[model samples]
Target chain A: MDEFGIIATYFAPLAGDGAFGLKDDAALLPARPGQDLVITTDTITEGVDFFAFDPSADIARKALRVNLSDLAAKGAAPAHYLLNLSLPHTITPDWLAGFAAGLAQDQQEFGISLLGGDTGATDGPLTIAVTAFGFVPQGKMVRRNGARIGDAVYVTGTIGDSGGGLAIFKREKHTLNDADRNALIARYRVPQPPVGFAEGLRAIAHASVDVSDGLIADLGHVASASGVRLVVEGERVPLSQPLRTLWGDHALSRAVAAGDDYQIAFTAPPGLEGPFTQIGRVEAGEGVGLIVDGKAVNVARPGYRHF
Target chain B: MDEFGIIATYFAPLAGDGAFGLKDDAALLPARPGQDLVITTDTITEGVDFFAFDPSADIARKALRVNLSDLAAKGAAPAHYLLNLSLPHTITPDWLAGFAAGLAQDQQEFGISLLGGDTGATDGPLTIAVTAFGFVPQGKMVRRNGARIGDAVYVTGTIGDSGGGLAIFKREKHTLNDADRNALIARYRVPQPPVGFAEGLRAIAHASVDVSDGLIADLGHVASASGVRLVVEGERVPLSQPLRTLWGDHALSRAVAAGDDYQIAFTAPPGLEGPFTQIGRVEAGEGVGLIVDGKAVNVARPGYRHF
Candidate 1:
């Protein structure tokens, strides 16, 4: 089939009611009264964002979930998404079928649907750019610049699992059992985006950001944006048992500097630590500081910085 | 400098008031009451969409203008856009500077601004996906499935200039003056999207589509979606002076069947022809028919289709 045939056979069904059956030049999304729309776009390229050999379905899920994580950090409900896929001639029907299936699963899981998109051929590796939209109450979005002095910094779930998974996939030496290794790889392949508590975080978090680029690095963004400093008790950060066992005293530092955690790192009043692990405090200064054994330590590597 | 530095230096300043200084994970766009947001996305790849040797600024302009053309076809006002740029290691700071400058110029000309976007590295070709947002009165978007029998079919501007220009770029034999040759090449490089009359089209056009995938193919989409046939007068299709003089009768067919025109083809009541040229009329059958010299003809190659 040609591009239109492929879209009609596989992708058209993923579109929502607003997509005009993928026939119109653009899709219609009616604005709700007293609501604000949040928009974010991310592109994943083979060998850079994901291993070229990774399953197509997992790659599709990862692409969508990463954007969803951004919306979660902003305290919005997933609404819809637009997909721009650039495929190589080597792409097969099975790969496209699996990719579409993955998007369908995520749509059901995340409460969003495909809005509209464009597909084109490329001579390079497969690439997909997803632009996702979410909705929040007017003026109620969680921001990255609201942290104040004395606010307690918190993180949801354990960090470093996805990064560790990548390490494992690269065949780095780690003393993890089979089950742990599989779990780590799964975390890296498909993130469990913290979508359940997005609304709650929006209501309570003084500042929030998703841990896409590493804990210390993302918190540095919060610190820089809020014009404050963050003092993180490195040992207090949650790490997977296997990661901790394998890295020991190095686990916290590694987790704080590794990317792809996809967890929520936020700050709130000390009394409002409802479901997150308190790991630090906001201070009146600049930059991020890590405390290990009650002593401030410098981080040589802040996080992944793509150029 | 890294990715964040690149964004802060070249792209952040282009973001509009709702972009949160390009610091947040997502940008906020508050919807107006009784308005609907129209969304469209297009991905342009290096070498595939444009010559790799083309100017970076022109490439950026082309990428954004293509999506803008879609919104114009939908009869929506350009609002904002998100850019997802994948750069290879070979990209230079000069290229980034020129690209951003191009975007700045268009933002002012089109009355839109950058919202938020993502930047990442790609080992392959440079690829950009632009997701644009626009606004129209609630439920007032001009779609491609509303054409009625006996409705006058109209088209704005001339068709096949861009495609012909591309052929000219490849050193194809064409007997044209230098001024006309440059004009054709310029049309291929930077599309002059007919955006000023979008609202007028919304009020009058029963159905409309941008001539991107050639006239016949895009019009076929309208016919299929509307469940009606179109009888187009081949000689009535407007052609640029140079194209007409160079190819004559062959020019009409080639121009009508070639892609990258970026002109608007619409259907409306005969009394509402306005400024657009009447090219044909809608009929009660299915598919598109082209009449050449009083004889119905078949389009052997109906535009560009990517598989």
Candidate 2:
């Protein structure tokens, strides 16, 4: 099908009120009385982000969820998104259908809707860019530079599961059972961001950041921006059971350096309770440090580098 | 340079207040008391959108202005944008500098700022996706479905100049002077959308659309959505002096069917005064039609198509 045909057949139905049924060039977002809009954009490429053999539905979900993770870290409630897709000629109608289905499923689950988007042809590998919009109360967006001295560092969910999944795809030999294997793979394919915790995080956290890069590298961003030092207790870093079984003793090291965790790593005053683990504390100095046992672990390569 | 380095060097300086110095994953846009946000996105691929030999600055501007045109057509004031870029390994640092310079220049001209974006490595051609945010008074955004019967069709600026430019790049024989040739090429490379006219157009237009696809194709969207017929006088379609020199008598036909004009086209009450030309009228019918010298002109191909 042509671009118009593809949009009409698979995407128009997914568009919501402000999208004008995907017939207009722009979409309208009505102003909220006391809310500030949080906007984030991310683009995922074919080989770099996902294998060509991966399900189209999963690919679509990954593109959306990655941006959603950013909003969650910023304490925003996602409301709408725009999708831009550059497809190679090899893409089939079935693939487009599956991709739209993925978006539809996520929109229903997350309470977000499609606003508007652009679709074009490219000779390159398929690329999907999603721009998401969310809302937070005015002046309440949790920022990276807000971390203060004495603030306790915490992280939501587990870290390194997605990295472990990628390792398995890269031919890592493991005796993991099918369920465990599938769980890890699913984590890589579709991120389960703590979107429900956005309001709470904004209310309590002194500073916040999503762990997209390695835990060390992302915490370093918070540290540099806030001008405070973040020291992590290495053993306190959460790792999935399947990932623990896969890597055993070396899991912590790998997890600390591996990227694509998509979990919120934040800081707040001590003695708080929530669905997070207290992993470290902020200090007066700068930079991020990880303590394993009695010595500091040397991080040669902090995270993935795109060049 | 790595992705982070590239961002810090070239993009961070372009960020504005809500961007948080590009340290955060997401950007915040504080709400305007009585304005509704208008959002639009467009992706441009290397070969499809522009020749690789084109200046990187021009490519960057083109990527931004196309989306800006959509907002202008919707009568929204441009405010901020998110940029997503997938670069091949062959890109040089100089090219990136030029690209950022291009964005910097346009950001100043359009009164917009960079928010946050993603950069990734791709083995394929360069692809840029820009999501622009703009604002209009609450419930005042012109819609494609608001065209009324008996409304007059009007278009801002001349048409087919960009198409003429593309033809020249494709080695189409033309005896035009260097200045004229350069003028056409410039229009193709960087669109000068009628942004300043947005407020006035929104106040007057019954329905509006930007001419990206051929005039017939884009107007057809308005007709289909608004359930009316748009009739264009072929001779009345605006043609630039340089385009007239290039295509002679054939310019009108080519101009009406050419895409990428990035000009606003709207339907409003007859006898209205403005900087736009009255090209046609809306009728109680469906689809779009072209009339030339009292006879109907058949258009086999309506506009540019990507598949």
Candidate 3:
């Protein structure tokens, strides 16, 4: 199909109210009375982000979810997204259908809709860039530079599962059952961001960042931005049971340094918490420190580097 | 440099308010009391959009201006943008610096700022996606489906210069002077979208679109959406002196069927005076028709197609 035909057949139906049926040059975003718009964009490429053998639906979901995760970290409720796809001639109608299907399902699940986007052909590998829009109460966006001294550090959900899943795909030998294997793979494919915690997070957290470039690296960002040090009790950093079984002793280090966790790592005062684990404390210093048992553990590689 | 280093060194300086020095996961866009936001996104690839030898600054500006063109066509004032860059390993710090310089220059000239973005490594060619945000008075954005029978059609600036420039690059021999050759080449590398005409366009136009995919094809879009036919006096379609000198008698046809003009085409009442030329009229029919002298003209290829 041509560009117009592909859009009409698979994407136009996914467009929402402001998109003008994807027929206009631009889309309108109506102003909300007391809300500020939150915007974030991320691009995922074939091979670098996902294998060509990966399910087309999952690839679409991953691209959208990555941006959604950013909005969630900033305490915003996602409302719409723009998807720019650079496709190769090798892409099939079935792949496009599956990709659109994934976006449709996620739109319903996340209460968001397609706004407007551009699609083009490229000789390069397929690339998908998603720019997401969301809303937070005026002046209520939780910032990474708000972490203060003496604040308690917390993180939502487990970390390192996605990294572990990636390792398995890289030919890491594992004596595991199919369920555990598939579960880890699923975590790598589709992120389960704590989007539901956005409102509550804004209400309590002094500072926030999503665990994308590993738990330690993301915390380091909060530390540098807030000008405060983060001290994590390495054992308290949560790891999935399957990941633990996969790597045993070395899982802690790998998990803390790995990327694509997509969990929220934040800081707030002590003694008030829900749906998160207290893993560390913010101090009047700089950088992040990982303490395992009674000694400081060294992290050779902090996170994923795109250079 | 790593992704963080690259962002901190090159992109952070270009960030404006609500961007948080490019440190936050997402950026904030404050709500304007009486205005609605207009959003549009477009992606340009390395080999497809420009030659590899094109100036880095021009490439950056081209990537940005394409989306800016869409906003202008919708009668909106450009405000902010999100950039997603997929860079290959071959990129250098000097190239990045030049690219950032281009963005900085346009951000000043167009009164827009970088909000936030993502940079990732790509195994393929360099790809840039820009999502621009603009504002229009509430419910006042120009639509493609608003044209009516008896409305007069108008277009701003000249058409086909960019396409003629592309032809020169593709080794189409020309006898034009050096200055003229350079002018056409400049049009291909950098677009001057009629941004200042946006407010006036909203006030007068019933339906509008930017002339990107050739005048005929883009006008065809308005015709199909508005359910009215557009009849154009072929000679009235403006062509630059440089392009006319290059293509001679064939210039008019080529101008009407070439893409990337970045000029605004709109419909309004007959005899309305403005900075645009009267080129055609809306009729009680469908599609677009071109008339040269007393005979109808045929367009073999309507516009540039991605697939």
Candidate 4:
């Protein structure tokens, strides 16, 4: 069958819930009345962001999860997405079938159907681009610039596990036991963004951002945007058992600066919070820093570098 | 410098008219009253879409034009764009400067600013993912499903030139004189999209499509969408001098199937005037076909295949 025929047979059925599926020139999903639409796009590259030699299902899940995490940062629910998928010429029919199954499973989990997008074969490495759009109520969207001084710094779920998980998966110069190793590996393979928790905090949290990069690195984004000092308490930073068992000396720095955690790091005023575990406090200072046991520690490294 | 700093230094300073520029979580542009927004995205790969050694400015222009052509097909005016650019680690400082300049130049020409997107470097081939947005008044937007059985077929500008140009440039088997070579090479390098003509036809055209693929293939899109058959007069298909000179006996078939022409191919009633040239008429049938002096031609090709 032709490419269009294949798309119509397999993909078109999944897109029926969309206002304009694969039929129109572009998808036009109607926004809920009195709501603002939130859009975010992320592209995954082979060897850089992911690898084909690895388990394809894991790669696909990570791709879908990372994009979903972006929406979670906005405290928005999953709605629909556009997938621009490119494949290397070496891709076989079986690979495509597996890839499509991965996508179907993710769509089922996230409750977002494919609206419309493009497909092409390239001679380069595999690349996947996904743009997820969701609806958020007017004046209720949490931004990175709404943090206030004296706000309690909060984070849902633990961090540094994914970074440690990556270290174990890559088999780099790291030491972690099997139980700790497996836990980290799962985090690396699938960083679940706390979508429900994010939605639950919409009315409480002042500002939020997802921890794709490390804790200190991503907080810098909020601090810079909100124009306030974020002084994270060293003990307030959460570290996993695997991280404790792994790097004894560098654990704090790694836990604070390692990325790909996929957890939500947010801020709320001192005592008016429903959810969110108290970690530290936003304060009047210059930029972003960590106060470990009442002393400022030098941030030697920030986080993962995309370049 | 970091990713954010690099953008602030080189790219952000160049984007003066963007909705939110580089400061927000997402760029918000207000859609015009009484008009609907049209959006499309295309990713250009190094070896698949263009040669890696090509001029960066030319590549940028081609990337922007491809998405703009999609908007032009819907009779929309260019508004803004988002770019997710990936590069190899081998880029020099000088090359980065040139690429930034090229983007700045095109942003000025199209009256669009780079809103917000991610950029990273990897070991993979260069990939440029551009999403362009345009606007057209509601209910006045042209689509692929408006063709009627008695309407005349029309096409703006020339065809078959880009395909011929590619052949000459890539295949050293052919040689050309300086003037002819320049014209053919220009056609391949920068095929002009009929944006102004599309806007002019808003009142007259029943249906329209930008002829990225050759005539017969694009016409098939209309036939499938609108459920009407179209018969093209083979001799009436437009061709440039170089294309006519290059293919000779096979010129008609080549013109009908060659892709990347990027001209506008539309359909309207016989009595319509402005922004369109008569080629043939729509007929009552199931599929699109070509006729020459009342005789059918068995042309077996349909546009360029990405595979």
Q: lDDT per model, in order?
A: 0.89, 0.92, 0.92, 0.74
How would the docking of model 4 be graded?
Answer: acceptable
- For model 3, residues B108-163, the per-residue Cα lDDT tens digits are 99999999999998878889999999999999999999999999999999999999
Candidate 4, which segments miss by more than 4 Å at Cα?
A1-6, A16-20, A30-33, A173-179, A246-249, A272-275, B14-19, B29-33, B172-174
List of clashing residue pairs for candidate 3: none
Runs in model 3 deviating more than 4 A are none
What's the DockQ for every one of the candidates? 0.86, 0.90, 0.89, 0.38
Q: What is the lDDT of candidate 3?
A: 0.92
| TM-scores of chain A across candidates | 0.97, 0.98, 0.98, 0.91
Worst 10 residues of 1 chain A by lDDT: A244-253
lDDT of 4 by residue, B10-68 (tens): 77866544334565444444334566667677777777567767677777777788778
Q: How would you encode candidate 4's per-residue C-alpha lDDT over A258-282 as one tens digit per residue?
A: 8888788888877655545677888
lDDT (10s digit) by residue, model 2, range A213-295: 88999999999999999999998998999999988999999998888888999999987889999999999998988899968
Tens-digit lDDT string for candidate 1 (A176-262): 888888888889899988988899998889999999999999999999999999999977898988787656677887889988888
Weakest ten-residue segment in model 3 chain A by summed lDDT:
A173-182
Model 1: per-residue Cα lDDT over B157-260, one tens digit each: 88988987888877785688898888888889898779887999998999999999999999999999999998899888988997776566689888988888
lDDT-better candidate, 3 vs 4: 3
Docking level of model 1: high
